[model samples]
Structures are given as C-alpha cells and as structure tokens.
Target: MKIDDNFYMKLAIDEAWKFQLLTYPNPAVGCVVVKAGKLLAIEAHKEAGLSHAEVNALKTAFLTQEPNSLLKVLEKSSEIHDFLIKNHNGFFEDCEIYTTLEPCNHHGKTPSCAKLLSILKPKRLIIGLIDTNKIASGGIKTLESENIDVTTKVLEKECENLLLPFKSWQNKTSIFFKMAQTLNGSIDGQISSQRAKLYVHTLRDKIDLLMIGGNSVRVDKPILDTRYVKGREPDVFIYSKNKAFSQAIPLFKVPNRKVIISDDLFKLLDYKFVMVEGVYTLLDILKDKLDFVVLIISPKIRNGVNSVNELNIDFEILHENYLGDEKIVFLKRRA
Candidate 1:
C-alpha cells in the first residue's frame, strides 16, 4: 500500500498537539518513519533542550528494526544521531520521514536534524511547515543540497496553527485564558474528565505564571499546583481587591511558589507565557488582552450556574478536538 502523505502528516500534527505548551521555548513537533509504506515509528518532541521530533522518530525507527542495538537506550540527540550515522548501514535509505515542522538546520542544545537526514539519505523528506526561525530555517535547502527528494507544506495550515503558540510567545508575552464547563455551560464543580484535568495540569507545568480570580481561590481552595503531572509549580497571581484572606488556602502553602494577591491585571505583562483561569467576569476583564481562549466542554449537562457572563467578544476557532469525552477548543479573538 502506498503511504498517504496528508494522512501521515495529519497524524504527525495530532501527535505534536499532545506535547503542545509543554515544550516551552521550543516548538512541539512530530515525525513518522515509513519503510516501504510500513510505519516504523511515530514520535514527538517531548520537551525543550531535548531531541527534535525527527531525531526521536529516527532513533525509534532504528531501534524498532534493530532492537538489540545500543541506540535503544540512548536519549541524547547528538548520541542518537551519531549512533544512527555510524550504524544505520542504509537501513533508512528505503524509508521516508514525515514531520510536522521542517527539521532544524542550526545546532543549539541538540545537533542539527537536517544534517543527520542528509547524511542518512532517506528516500524522501515530507515536511509540513518550514521553520520560520532564522537560525533553523535552512533545513529544506540542506536536504535539497544532498539531492534528497523533498516535499514541502503537506497540511501546512494545520501545522502553522500548531506553531502559533511558539511563534507568539517568541515575539511577545503570550497569554491565554482557560476554563472548563459542562454542556449546559455550567463552570462549577468537577466537570472535565480526569484526562482533561491532566492536560490542564501539564499546561500549568509549562507556564511561567497562572492567574485566577480571587473568588476562585477563596471558594474552591484549589491547590493549583501541577501535582497531577508533577511539573514545576508556577507562580500564582490572584486577581482580587481584598488582600486579606484566610492563610489556609492551599496555594499559599506550596513550597517555593510565589503567590501574589493584587488588583492590578497589568502585572501579567511581567511574564512571558501566562494562563488565566476564570469564567465570564474574568474573561470580560481580559477580553482585550488575551491571545487565545481554551474552553473545555464536558459531555454531561445539568442545571447549574452558567459560565458565561455579560460579555461580547467574537472568536475564531483555531483548533478543536476531543479529550476523552470533553471537547477542547482553542480560539482567538477575530481580527
């Protein structure tokens, strides 16, 4: 069976979304290795300062074909690239690689992925979006210089949508508001699935700071730490006029976490990547400043207080998908 480039590239896009926001200062990317139309590996860039998606996928493909090889246990990108270049023995010459983003040409914390692919001489390179970063943008040219068959912009729009957060945060302080609600629009209680909660925790792990209404802090007494994902605790900014609250709030007790209580919203500008969690009242206050809005709508609907407040702001849907019975949407204000 011949491989569908769009199908595999869409799969790669979906894979990359899993690690979105988790790869701070780096773009989330995914890759697939196919040998004679059979998939050898599907991998993604999991974190910053680690291997790119192409390198991880290539390493996984190598180990899948040669399980006992020392490459199986290697984690570093440079080491993996070296092992593959030294031991590949033309294993990937018959394989095609699909990646959501063009492989990087410049070396930073990791080795150059384009250089590795050039040396390996894969049958073809199918990429979604060309890297826009000046330092990393020459991968396509590098691959072509080696006479490798290259296809660009497969599912380009979806790939570009995946990359918006990375590009936005790089240029300015990117802020997004997130809320979990039921089908009836009730934002109260635990409505999201456990998996959805985990997704929020993972996002909390990556952000520099988290902003929430003072009302939420007092009522829910939320721990607000990344306990579910065991990620670094982000600073919390409570948007409240009354600084006097019970000292027993769980967030205040998180070790090494900076908890700030203030009425000023501009304090958000001090951080690069920030998350705001609230309903209509908070959204109304932040409507003009937010870059994105993440809404999680759970399946079950019941009579309760609705999440929406008296707010009028139009949004353009950027991406929408399911997270285990919950519908997650990423929206941006319509320009």
Candidate 2:
C-alpha cells in the first residue's frame, strides 16, 4: 500500500489502542516519526511513569542515528528530554511526528513532551485531539511558538474514542458495558469464541474495577479475573442488593482481590475505569451512566438467550472492529 499521512496516523492509532488497558490512569497515545517518507520510529505508551509514545519514538529514532554510542539516563522522561534537546539539533528538523493525542506541556513525573518537541524541532506535529486536561493542554501553543507546523483533528472521532478512558479518569469514571451474543441474538450459552472470552480477560488485567450483575454470578458462578492474559486482575464490584452470594463461587475465594457488594453505581465514580458485563436488566439500570458498549458478535445462533434483543434503547455505533471469529462493535447511547 502506498503510504500517506493518513496511513501513518492510522498506524499510530492501532499501536495506541493495543495498550489502552495497559496504561491505567494514563491515555494510551501512539506516535510515529516520519522523515522524507520513511518511518523512523513508532511507539505507544505501555504503562504509566514510563516514556510516553512521542518520547519513546524519539528515543528509538535517535538510537538509529547513534547506534554505537549509549545515551545515558535516556529512559527517564526528564533525561530523555534533555538528551534529545542537546543531541537533536538538525536530526529531526525536517521530520514529522503523528500522535494520537496532543503533546503534553506539563512537568510532572516527567518533562513536558511539548517542551521536548519544541527543542527537537520536528517539522510538523499531527495531533488527533487537544488535551482537555488543564495540566497538559497548551502543547499546541508551545510548538506553534517555536515555528513548528501543527495539525489538529486528524481522525478526531477515533482519537476521541481512544482518549475516552483517560478523559473519564479526569472527569468521571468510564464504564464500558460488554455483552457477547450470537448472530441471531442468543447469549444464553457460550456463543462467543474462546478467543473473545480471552480478550475480555485480557482487558480485565488493566481495568480498575469490574461490575457484574448478581443474576450472572448466581447462574454462571464465574471467576471474572484476568487469568487468561497473565496480568493484574481488577477489583470486583458486584451489583447485587442482597449479600447472600455463594461462598462456593470462585470469585469469592480469590486471595487479595477486593470484592465490594453494592447496588449503588455511584460508588463507581470514584474509580478511574470500570467494566460491566451483564444482560438487559443490568444494561437498563446503567443505561444513563454507560460511556461505551462492546457488542461481541458471535457466528453461531444459539436459542438460549440474547442481550441485544433485550436492549430497549437506541445506541450509536462509535467504532466496529473484528477480533478473532467475532466482530467487536463499540457503541454508546443515542439518547
């Protein structure tokens, strides 16, 4: 495929999305540095307190220029900033960086990405969305003042979707309601593929909280941890009014995992990110509070039960992507 700015930005988004769960309390941002139509480096934020996407990309790209010599203290964000500023006099003068979110301008935990970019002097900075957080929003101005070209709102909607978790953490806790159903709308049995099931578990590793309905727990007696991905499991939030849950349930026996039983969804606001997996009644109860929905489309048509058929409200499909043999549709309320 012939490469263009759009293609590069799309690649950045793909890279960023992979780590959305991994970077808890931090936005999963991706960056790609292109020089003379050649890809210099591509990177995404893997976790908090580590090098951000832009800094990581710059570090990797810089290494290609100086492979024989080691740059000391470059892994830390502040050190990376100072190193790049001192070394990248004209190395990135004509290069362009495509990023999924605005470069940060604040100095906390690390040096400001905007300040580093200003010093490195990239030819252009293509941004998806301006940072809404007050602490990191003025990066565009800083870059512009340094005479670097800047572009905003490239793939804005998709970038907004990518930033949803981060924004939620800043304002209110983000809740994504997930449901797996057959093509004909049956979810009674396991219609979703094993891969899809594992994918859900992988997400479980990164989230702060998991909210499951009482009925599903009673009937399924499931363990909703992130064992499949070998990552840290999230705290469990049970949405049952009654405290008479089963002691035999594996979820209750998990060591060191905090399990809170309550019907009030208000408690979730205190969390950064929360995942809810339930059928219609659960969805209806959280209809007004939900920020996103994952409708797992299974190929099989079982007749046991279905969550989509039970949905009573209209939804807006934010984005749709396939996973394994299933189609993952991300949606929000039309209301």
For candidate 1, list the clashing residue pairs, or say none: none
lDDT values, one for every candidate: 0.89, 0.83
TM-score of every model versus the real structure: 0.92, 0.87
- Which segments of candidate 1 are over 4 A away from where they belong? 1-3, 320-322
Clashes of 1: 0
Model 1, range 1-335, lDDT digits (tens) per residue? 54489989987888888777779889989999998888988889999988889988898888887899888789888899899899999998999999999999988899899999999999999999988899888999999999999999999999988898898798789899999888888877677888998999989988999999999899999999999989899999999999987889889999989988999977888899999988888999989888788899898877777855677788878778788878888887887
Backbone clash count for every predicted candidate, in the order shown: 0, 1
Clashing pairs in 2: 187-305
In model 2, how large is the Cα lDDT of residue 174? Answer: 83
lDDT of 1: 0.89
Tens-place lDDT per residue, model 2, 1-335, is 95767788888888887676568778889999998667988899988899899999988887777875456445787777777787786999879899999999998778889998998888899998888888888999999999999999988888888887677666778888888888887778667778888889877876788999988899999888777787777889999999798789999887668998898878887787898988788888888888778888988867775544455688777656678778888776786
